[model samples]
Target: MNVKMNGFISLVLGIGLLHTASAATHSLKYFYTAVSGDIDYPEFTAVGLVDNGQFMYFDSSTKTAVPKTEWMKREGADYWDSQTQGLIGEHQTFKVNIQTLKDRFNQSKSTGVHVVQRMYGCEWDDDSGATEGFDQYGYDGEDFIAFDLKTTKWIAPAPQAVITKLKWDSNTANNEHRKNYYTQECIDWLKKYMDYGKSTLMRTVRPSVSLFQKTSSSPVTCHATGFYPSDVMVSWQKDGQDHHEDVEYGETLPNDDGTFQKSIHLTMTPEDRKNNKYQCVVQVKGIKDDFIRVLPDQDATNVVPIIGGVVALLLVVVAVVVCVVIWKKRSKKGFVPTSTSDTDSDNSGRAAPQI
Candidate 1:
């Protein structure tokens, strides 16, 4: 499958779902990133998401896997311990992969930074119980390689990764194993995870949608926040026609309270607004009603930026706090190696912290 995570560095992949919408879907994903320098951050870090909702996290510093939600804590220590071990294996592998990538990219002599990242996951269609799996890798914020199940092939998107792809594709047994892992094992784990956090994961929350301008010169942004499952669509219309010009879509992000938020900007001038009717429409996957805000509404101005900025700021603070806590708790006695950093990313889009 073609993975869609694009804004990984800032950690807003802008998107996935949960609560098994009758026609909606949920996803179970894992993101891992390795950096190649001694930065005051995790050398290796991984996160697990169910329907784009993060449930667990692990990093080289803490050397432990921990649950992020109360419902996730239902799993015993053994489960967390097993996850820790699994991430530990991944950490070592990524450490080596970073170096190998450095060599492959001929960046060994470079003084700057380098990174390798992996994001793999499965999406489950709740209505029909259909599942799709994808696996991809990136280097220095660009696409590198991905696995295709139908052909059981490892495809390299970049020429630099061709040699590695050829080597991986040549290994029939390993390819078969990967195929089974994505199709069967990954789905099995995903189902179990949904069950494990059903109370929280099974609920749906509608978004509070708004339309406002940051400044008179700024675009009119359709903002949606405080929704669950993260899968949402915000669009614009002019004179009852679909409007797409100069529209900017933003990354879907998580709030401090575990809800999700997103904003899309529609650029227009005050003069243009007077001649055409403009409306902001929001459609959440499971919620049946459409939330709409027409232009010239008495209350629809000068609110989005303040709200959006506050949400974005709060998210950054939470992320920083979590990262800092993990770093502080990390064991100082472990072997330190050169590696790159990873940003906690999104579902449809593959993203990581820029190296």
Candidate 2:
């Protein structure tokens, strides 16, 4: 018996409604990358899944939604290995087939994500129940393609003859074969993986910002760091207008700790800085508010208090120094030197007043 499949069935029943319990949508993806030259190689192949529009599963060695039993793992690994060989071999017939699958998946995911967005906005549920689907992609040298299982269509960009042959094959035994593999067995595995990932994936971390100046006159840079969900946008603005020129954008990259970071710079001339204000704005997907950083201006409002404090401090210091000097001078002049001799009068050797 399928242990994982039984657990999925029990979960749906225990939750009362599959529509409410199961993910609103499911997606399976196949990724392939290969290089060719004096040395030919198929570098990597991975299968991934997305549930309810969130990334859920990606493993290079294992097939999606497969049973975790030792026998099944070995079998699934062998099957994927064979599939990879079909993609790598020269003069292969499966290349077009693979490309078709990739195209179908690309189309599905592109459209599927949109559907989920609409579902989120709807007031009431259609109650049509939970749905599952798979998308496939293949990359060979410079070529890329996709296939969507839901639409039973190919998205391979290739010669007409090759595409035509793929269409014919897909309509025949390939159709039944794919339906069995994806809809039935693979989906069971997808459910298993989804359950495992639900508790494990990181979510709901906000980004932090750091600002720095390159030089006395160079542009200011804003670095936004430690954000979850890789899709974040960082932009620069001046006096309420978005400035595109003299702006350098850095690619968003993953941090070692599984978060993401991005940097953007805005160049403001001396004249511009004197007249207007600048702000850095960051927007993250699923975040309600945008993160904004306004450039510090030495305008009257800010500079007045600072200048006033400095002047006051200087005045206090000067006053203290003047008082000390006056006191010391008075003490020195008033000093009546005691005569060493008993009867010696006051200022004889001290140089009498010129008056």
TM-score of each: 0.81, 0.45
lDDT of each: 0.66, 0.39
What's the lDDT of the predicted structure labeled candidate 1?
0.66
Clashes of 1: 17
Cα RMSD (Å) between model 2 and the true structure? 35.0
RMSD for all candidates, in order, please.
9.2, 35.0
Q: Which lDDT tens digits does candidate 2 get at residues 122-203?
A: 0111145344433222222112223344545444443422444365345644544444455555555555544555543325
Error in Å for residue 12 of model 1: 5.2
Which stretches in model 1 have alpha-carbon errors above 4 Å?
1-8, 12-22, 297-355
Q: 1-355, model 1: which lDDT tens digit per residue?
A: 1112332234423322112223356677777877766455678888777776778888998899988988888788767776777677678888878878787778777655566777677777767878777777767766677777678876676788788777877778767766666677677777878887887887778888877665667777777888876777788999999999999877676776778878788888777887788898888776888888877732445434444565565467347333211111111122122112221212112222111
Q: Candidate 1, 115: how far from true, in Å?
A: 1.7
Strongest candidate by lDDT: 1
